[model samples]
Target: MPLPHLLRRRAPRSGARRTARRLAVTVPLVSLAGVLALTGCANRERDAAPGAGTSTTASSAAQTAAFPVQVTVPGTDHAVTVERRPERIVSLAPSSTESLFAIGAGEQVVAVDNQSNYPEQAPRTDLSGYTPNIEAITGYNPDLVIASNDTEQLVASLEKVKVPVLLLPSPHNLDELYAEVTALGKATGHLTEAEDLVRTMRSDIDKIVKDTPKPAKQLTYYHELDPQLYSATSRTFIGQIYGLFGLVNVADAAGGTGDYPQLSPEHVINANPDLVFLADTKCCGQDAAAVAARPGWQSVTAVRDNGVVALNDDIASRWGPRVVDLVRTVSDAVTRTAQQG
Candidate 1:
């Protein structure tokens, strides 16, 4: 689920010139949110209680809403059938684990991959670690398995063993994110709830679109992946946030690497972004402004104006329920900067 793995580095420590620009960096825990949890035998409630209720029909609606389906994920040969609502579930990705928890199915999740720490409860649950331990997962006796792009092999074996697996294709942008959330919600028999969340999320996005203070000029921004000045591609999710606010990513015009591409200070100096967004606060000793203050950055427009904005690493990145906050934060940054401009 680590769809984005930009190298982690230190950010610039210097503030930049005044400009209306915004950058969004989701939490560092996001990747753990991506490919996090795993499972084991000891913690399975089904095993603890003999003959646990296998009532596929927890209710008439649940039974009807849940059933078998063949879902084809990206980079896979064929669609696979998911037998039911997955009374016992295993999450092989941190994002999938976070997604399940967001939809209220955390209890149904018997295990998760390693690194899924945000929902600390997930780690506390039985875990098979980063990789799949078929025996351990089998011991927990999960009805369904959720696998990220990297874990397709595990999914294959689970399929051979007759265990249903949900192949979760990694999302590239916000639209795909909406689709994944809706898909997972439906798969989990929480379609209505998921749809409702989508509606609310869209509403938040719409407000950002509408209420965004019209700037007289398109402000330029740079999203630092780490302490390093490496920038995100224009096609990336975080890059799209700047676009949504009608701001410019200097890298966009320069043609970003379409991924987090580390660049020389000379590159940033030439791009001359008006705003600098750091991926984190100083809490962990990672500072964005300091990066801008490095020897060659002194002349950049952003460095002169104090336009460096530190963001919450998690909320800024995730496309889940917290996306509302992403839009809000972006909109606020845009509006705040626009007013000052």
Candidate 2:
């Protein structure tokens, strides 16, 4: 699980509030046993172009997982010698379900994670690791079970089942995200399509960077996950989006490596950002005003200037086709400043 690091360098302090807001809402709505589900809440684009099996040798792991799934996704990495293609698949995470859907195998997903709610047509299967529903998952007679990793109960439950289980690592950044897409594509006999999609995503991003204003300032932002709000570190997907827009994320002050770091009231007051974007409002639970009235948040530009923006939880957390929307949202937030300049 040695993941690559990718995020902005200097994140805003006050914006750290955004993290809690996001996790609070998204985790419950999409959490598959305390871990965030891919919720199919796409941001509109991924960095890779929208093509699968397009070009460039995939990874050693990618080669090993070579298409036309045989048995099941090995619980281990790159253990691709399965017995058959996953015709009846059950997803334990929303993102895992969404990944299958993205590769044109939506019909194959017989059952979905409890939180899965994208495409508006996923089956209402009673599958969730929260309650340990092995019978429910097995009831679908699935050949493959795509479950989230790092869940003890979920992992243990899958091993007991005779079916093949593909344990996908939770995505921490862009490369991992792409890897997930590619791996899932191979399993579904859609590597070629996945490759194409990734390529198209990259091309689109290149265009965004080439066409957008490139003043050294980048965009300065404060992203909140909740009303009390924690912010993302310089190495998270949300943080990376700000980087893609050349926006300076001020959360780095409180952000850690893998996710948004918790911010103290003192820290929020000290490193106020230009704009504030709150993620996943469900976590706020009627706490925005109360959180807003807290000691030092009022001093931050987002609070004072009323620049705080509540984001769409579905599109912001999923990292699906909608990743571009997140970028666009960030772009618009920063564009306001560009216009004033």
Candidate 3:
């Protein structure tokens, strides 16, 4: 699902660098695996999936070790331990929810935040990741809760009730994203499946980057978060994906302090990016035509050459398995632009 209308354009709550790193952007389909050797993101030694010829004793030991897994929360020194495989999991972060379902832990999810609308089968509830209600959450009797933030002292509150919470924040890069997947897998006892998913994702993304045609003249782009011209810079996570294709982000030169910067229409027109990626299709009803109709935007190079791309809000907003799809979409657009040139 698209971010809540009010939050669709809000910057991150942290410092400038982190703030700039979190803006939603167009996702690519057919995703990446640049480094497969990262056993687990939290520094835990991962045992390989038992071979078919492995002894039963070894397999049993592997299964035993899968539990009592400990994962360091992303961007923090503190770690949370999953004492046992979580049977009743409640996910408050949409990205984490998607990761759980993708890693084969769907059946273990007892409930998910309302924003976790993908997978369709996720037990969608009225629970809010933002401003969570302690009573409503504890009522579900969840063994584990995964959220993006500790909003309203949620972690402390849950701890008071003896419920374990895993804080998986928005990743700063692909490596961090993979680590989150690894962490979730370990926490849920699906480490092997998670490793497999990471390998596939890495392989797919690497292929997409290598196969896409690189334009002779490097293409420049503008990633629109909304009609108001809020944009993501090259320093952001989505920006790194664009960097894979050698696309330049005009927002970087717009003199904004963070990853998600609100650019003046004048700066965009002056930069006149070769491509305009709209991430507000679902939230704000924007499209190529709407962009062309904007005051002075018709003169933008992207508009004149039909280079405006409308991205799926949900896919663009979440960094998960579907990132491969987002990558594919960008690849197709880059191919078209190169062909036109």
Candidate 4:
């Protein structure tokens, strides 16, 4: 999902910078051993269908450790102490909304931002996560607020009123994703459930990778963030998922600033990626035909071979439980491409 225009265009304040630095110090990087463990679990699950035998057990011991848990909110200097399991929660970001629901914290979610349109039962209100109103948010009397970005103004406003906020920025990699999920679980008294969810996601994603056959030659891919030619780099979380399949990112050479960079149409034509994954199918109405009709895009291999994959804009953009579904969709596309060869 593209960030709300307000967040994407606004410059970060000094306080936000300091908060980001604190997160860097507090959250340890995932170890190689941990990665291997996840991979091992994934391989086992691959032998069965994904989600067929998944377990959902919350350890009694873990529930005891949930309260009064103090965690350094990622991208914030302030460590929030959850005095008790939050009963009235507000999700400012769509990803956070999905995470809360996935970990069985949905019942505690009193309300969610306007952009949180998933799960069919989330309390969607007119609240704007991007341009949050302190008065409107406080009206709900939420004990906890979860958000993706920590804009200085928004954070200060909520803190002023004594509402605990968990600022979880878009994760750079899968390890960071796990940490975020774990933190949310501990904060909401769902630590065991969160751990289980993470394990399942890891297993399912790895299964997709394991089942996908390596192409005869390295495949080049273009992931379209919008019809305007914006794209994610190999270093971004979205790119890392595609990287798992050994697909080279065509946008890497653009050297675009930030995670997302806009590419010129001509540059994309010159690269001529083997596969095109359109994350803007819903947002921009882009499809294989739409891409082929673009001036100078008819010659692209992906278009010519009908290898353009239309994706759910929300799933592609949000780093949440449904990320596994995105991986499965991409894996299927890759399998088809390899078979055609």
Tell me, by TM-score, which candidate is best.
3
Per-model CA lDDT versus the true structure: 0.56, 0.55, 0.72, 0.70
What would the TM-scores of all predictions be?
0.75, 0.73, 0.84, 0.82
| Residues 169-203 of candidate 4: C-alpha lDDT, one tens digit per residue | 77767766778888888888878767987987888
Q: Which portions of model 3 miss their true places by more than 4 Å?
A: 1-65
Q: What is the per-residue lDDT of model 2 for residues 1-341, given as tens digits with 9 covering 90 to 100?
A: 11111111123224544333223223211111000112231222233464622332254235435644542333345344345556688876665566676665676788876567765777745565334467777788887777655354655665577676766654556666667667777776556656766665556556655666654455567665544455565565666666777667676766456465556667766777767766535434323465467777777776776566666655555554445555556656566666655
Better of 1 and 4 by lDDT: 4
Q: Which residue ranges in model 2 land beyond 4 Å of their true spot?
A: 1-80, 129-131, 153-156, 215-218, 255-258, 282-298
lDDT of 3 by residue, 291-331 (tens): 98889989998999999999876667677777777677789
Across 33-104, the per-residue lDDT of candidate 1 in tens digits comes to: 111211211123234344333432243267346576555544445455766767788776555666677655
Residue-level lDDT for 211 in candidate 4 = 87
Error of 1 at 51 (Å): 32
Better of 1 and 3 by TM-score: 3
Please identify model 1 stretches exceeding 4 Å from their true place. Answer: 1-60, 63-65, 72-78, 123-136, 253-258, 280-284
Error of 2 at 80 (Å): 4.3
> Which ten residues in a row are the worst by lDDT in model 4?
24-33
Ranked candidates, highest lDDT first: 3, 4, 1, 2
Displacement of residue 62 (Cα, Å) in model 2 is 18
